[model samples]
Target chain A: MIELHRVSKVYSVGPVKVPALREVSFRIGKGEFVVLTGASGAGKTTLLRLLYRDDLPSEGDVEVLGYGLVQMRRSQVAAFRRSIGVVFQDAKLLPVRTVYENVAFVLRVLGTPRRDITARAFDALRAVGLSARAQAYPAQLSQGEAQRAALARAIVRRPPLLLADEPTGNLDEAMAGEIVDVLKDIGAGGTTIVLATHQARLAVALRRRTLTLEGGRIVKDEG
Target chain B: MLGFLVGEALRDLRRAGRVAVSAVVLITLSLAALGGFWLVSSNLGHAVAKWRDRVRIVVYLKREPPGGDVAALLERVRVMPGVAGVVFIGKADALRALKQVLGKDAGVVDQLPVNPLPASLEVTPSAAAVTPEGARELLARLAVLPEADDVAGSADWVERFSHWQRLLTTIGLGVGFVLAAASILTVTTATTLILHARRHETEIMRLVGASEWTIRLPVLLQGMMQGLAGAILALGALVVTHSVVAPRLEPLVSLTLGLSQLVFFTPVGVVALLGAGTLLGGLGGWLARAAREP
Candidate 1:
């Protein structure tokens, strides 16, 4: 489902070329739930961004779901994105929109039929256990609820691949474990998942294949 | 999809709040100024058309045409280019017309030792010669006539009025353009603010596979809505002003311009104003989006 061959990304600040990812390489088959664990500046976010085509690697090839990330045209990027789901460290829900509206927003943008949108949105929200809090605004929801709402929004279209970046970063231990359980359920349903986090214990606890990165290079890959 | 876009646009406009309101106000003021000038120009155009038909040029002769030659001279003048018709007036007839014009003061004209009035030929120009340039050309031709002493045409005053109308239109266009530029800039600023305010929402939308059009169209629509609102308000202001002021100004207009009644913009003109406002607003929105995205 995904392959990155010697992908290297560099950021330029004046005269300095700061490498975010240096010769990083990985491959994962369909339906794999992979945990990308690393410290604060270990290039986890950069790798996910490259996979989602949000940023281009300065060198090497990155492919996801058969699309060559570097060669993809701008017009094709939106269509490619629709085939996958992405969640950020922050649950970027529109503050003014209710949780339900936030979830339904993705379907609306995809031009889903009016009749199907309610059913699909509700199903997604129900999957994330946010059905009861659907009408609550993001500001009113607890941090965990807001994150679940964001997850519902990401998965509403039933995209085959899901990428979550530090989704449980702000949650307590119990809340983080609950979110992982939800991610596990989603993965069990045959959606490929990549969850990035700085907490190594969470990756070990889940018993999933984990990739550890340090100084912009993947240092370990083991179950 | 269209409904969703419009909804998003409305939401953005609401979010823009005071900035949106200010943009609309600017548009309204600009359109109103332009529409006001158009209204005045329309009335002036009508007056010019009406007065053109009554334009007359009088060619005073050095002396009365000798005996039977008066009819021959009248026929000659009538056949000249742009001459619609000609009437020969003898000195006696000129004096009689003067006495009638002087009304109760006719006794003063009777007290003169002799009629000081010159016999003249009244020349009515055809439609082709009604224009200031056309009248001047015809006047030059008549002035060179063998028996012509002095030639005077009513075209001069009409020409002056036409000049004023043209000047007003030019000034109106200049002012309207400046105001339109200002409105567009205001709209751009307003849309930019909304874009910044919704940055997080936009990022989420993009990540969720929203198309570029889906992400950007709301900003454009917000600007367009502002323009549309401004256009409607401008039209309303113009109608109210015309209704309240036209009647009071009609008498003066009639006395000066000889127009029987004042007229407002035609249906086409109203549509044009609305279209212009919407286009201006849309342009502003498009610019803002382009600047941000590009």
Candidate 2:
């Protein structure tokens, strides 16, 4: 579903050049559950960001869901974004909007029909087992509930690709397992999932492809 | 999308009700500055026009008519810039005009052994001819004539009218400068506030494939609304004040010129004020978005 060819990212902060990813080439087929693992600056987030076009590769080409991301205009970036569901580690919900509204934000931005938006938002909430808390505020939800709400928001559009950056990084073991289960259920439904994690045991049960990085280069690829 | 923007704007206004009120108050005050000066300028124009219509300039011929020079002199003064048209009131015509004005006192005019008044060149200049500056120039040129006497007219009347116009002109310019400054300040504040409220949302919206106008229209619309509301509020207060006080002032100055004569902005004026106010609001939003958009 996503591919990178000789992609490299360089960040110029002050006069110094910091290289995040260097000549990385990889691909994950459709419906695959992949964990990208690395130490602090091993370019895991940079790879994820490149896939989303949040940050472009400084060199070579990157493709996401068949779109030639290098040639994609800024105007078309949002359309590319809509093709994927992204669950952030932070669960960045608008504090002023309600739980349902947070999930509905993407649809509203897309100018989806009002009735469709409400139905999809409700269904997404139900899928995440949060329909009862649909009207509640972010402040009212526990960490697990908030992450669940974030999941609902990410999947509300039924996007083909799901990218979660540290989906369970902030949760306890039980909560982490819950998030993993939710993500797995999504992957089972044919959405290609690429989750970024450093945990040793989290990606073991899934038995899917794993790409391990070290020193800005992929060191291990296991299936 | 419009509904969403309007809803968001209203919600923002509600959440930051104080800021919205401050925006309106600032905008209203700015408009009041413009409206008040406009009213004053309009009234001044009317007063000048009224004074101009009734006023006439008198050009007196020299004491020695140099035999046949009387008609030529009359012709010269008749063609002067401020001179609308001229009437050659010969000695006999002058006596007749005096008799008419004097009415029953016409007998006293006939008692005079000779016509003491000069065979004056009665020049009726346009209202534009009634200014101190214009009149001064006309008199200076007229006096240089060999047949001329010391030129004179209602200097006080011209002076008074011109004085008011100059004062009003200064105030109009000063008010205009103030209004422009206020517009920029208001637009900057409004646009910045709009952007700040939706910075993250805007980015996400863009990332999610929203168009430029889809994001910007709401901000511009909000600005337009702010301007409209402010102008309306200020004008409403002014109208109410006029209704209450103009009637009372009517007894004092019979020739009072005010909003009563205006018919309350003549629709076009109202539209312009509201349109301008709304534009100010929208412009603020546009500027904010535009600055970051490129």
Candidate 3:
């Protein structure tokens, strides 16, 4: 479902050209739960951004869900995005909305029927163990609970691919374990998951295929 | 989709709070000022038209002409190119007309030992000759008449009134433009504040594949609502102003210009004012959205 051939990313800051990814290539089949581990500035975020087609590669090709990122138009990018979900490090839930509304927002964007949205949003919240806090606003939630709410929002649309970039980066070890278990359940339900993080021990304990990035290149791939 | 868009718009408007209220107030003020000037200009235009139609050239004879000569001169003036009608006013008849115009002040006029008014030919000009250029031409012709000592008319005053009407219109437009600009800026600022406050939500929306319009339509609608509210308030204010002032001012207007009643905006004017307000708000919202980082 995903492929990148020697992809490289260079960001220009003033007169300097900084490389984020260099000649990196990877592939993940459908319904796989894969973890990406790297230190800070190891290009984990850039790799995830490329997979979501948020940023284009300076050199080489990227293919996600059979659409060539380089050739995609703006309309196609939007259409492509509907089939994939992203979870940011900060969770990025709307502070003004309750947890249920935050999850239902994705369904609303997809124009699901209100009746269906109610059922599906509740189910997604249940999966994340956030159904009890459905009416709680993001500001009122604990960091772990907010991340879980963000997870519910991400999966509300039942996207085929889920890309999480350090979703538990700010949580305690216990909270991180709980969040990862929820992600494991989501993966068991057949959604492909690509989780990027710098937590080496958590990545190993998850017991999934792990890819390590160091200086924008894949240093190890353990299937 | 429509319900969601509209619901989000209303929510945004509610969230806008003071900024939105201030925007409505600004719009109301802008449109009120605009409508006020428009009303003045309309009334002035009516006065100008009435005065133009009454424009005439008065030829003052050197002395009372013989009856036959008076008849001959009247016939000649009536046949002139731009002359609509001519009435010969004799000295006694002119004095009687003056007494009628002066009302209770006629006793002061009657105290004069001698009839000092001039015997003149009151020359009414045709519609085509009521213009500044046409009136000037006709006046020049009347001035050279053999029986004329001096010629005078209200044409100059009519022309001045017309100039004042034009000037009022220009000033109204200038003020309207400035106020509209201010309103647009205020609305833009309000929308930008909302944008900044909701930046996180917007980013999440994009991540979840929300359409561009799903994100933007609410902001546009919020702006439109502000504009519409402002226009409605301004219209309300205008109605109250007219109602309170029109009755008291009606007699003054009638006494001076002989108009039966004061006028307000026609239905078309009301629609245009509301449309202008809405457009101003829409423009501000659009600018706010355009300035957002995609």
TM-score of chain B of each: 0.84, 0.73, 0.80
Runs of candidate 2 exceeding 4 Å displacement: B59-123, B126-163, B179-183, B186-194, B251-264, B286-294
What is the descending lDDT order? 1, 3, 2
The candidate scoring highest on DockQ is: 1
Off by over 4 Å in 3: A13-16, B56-126, B139-154
Candidate 2 versus truth, CA RMSD in Å, comes to 4.5
Tens digits of lDDT, candidate 1, B19-97? 9999999999999999999899889989988888889999999999887899889888898998999998899999999
- What C-alpha lDDT values do all the predictions have? 0.92, 0.76, 0.90
TM-score of structure candidate 3: 0.85
Each prediction's DockQ against the real complex: 0.69, 0.51, 0.56
Give lDDT tens digits, candidate 3, residues A134-202. Answer: 999999999999999999998988899999999999999999998999999999999999999999999
Worst 10-residue lDDT window for candidate 1 chain B reads: B153-162
Model 2 lDDT at residue B281: 65
Residue A124, candidate 2: C-alpha displacement in angstroms: 2.4
Docking class of 3: medium
Minimal lDDT window, size 10, model 2 chain A:
A199-208
Candidates 1 and 3 compared: the better one by lDDT is 1
Listed in order, each prediction's TM-score against the native is 0.90, 0.81, 0.85
lDDT by residue for model 2 (B1-294), tens: 667767766655554455556667777777777766676566666666666665665667666465487677777776767777766667777878889999988899878998898866666666666777776776676667676565666445746865777788778668756775676566557667767877767765665556666677766666667767887887887678667765676554445532234323557877777776776666665676677665
Instruction: Give the number of the best model, judged by TM-score.
Output: 1
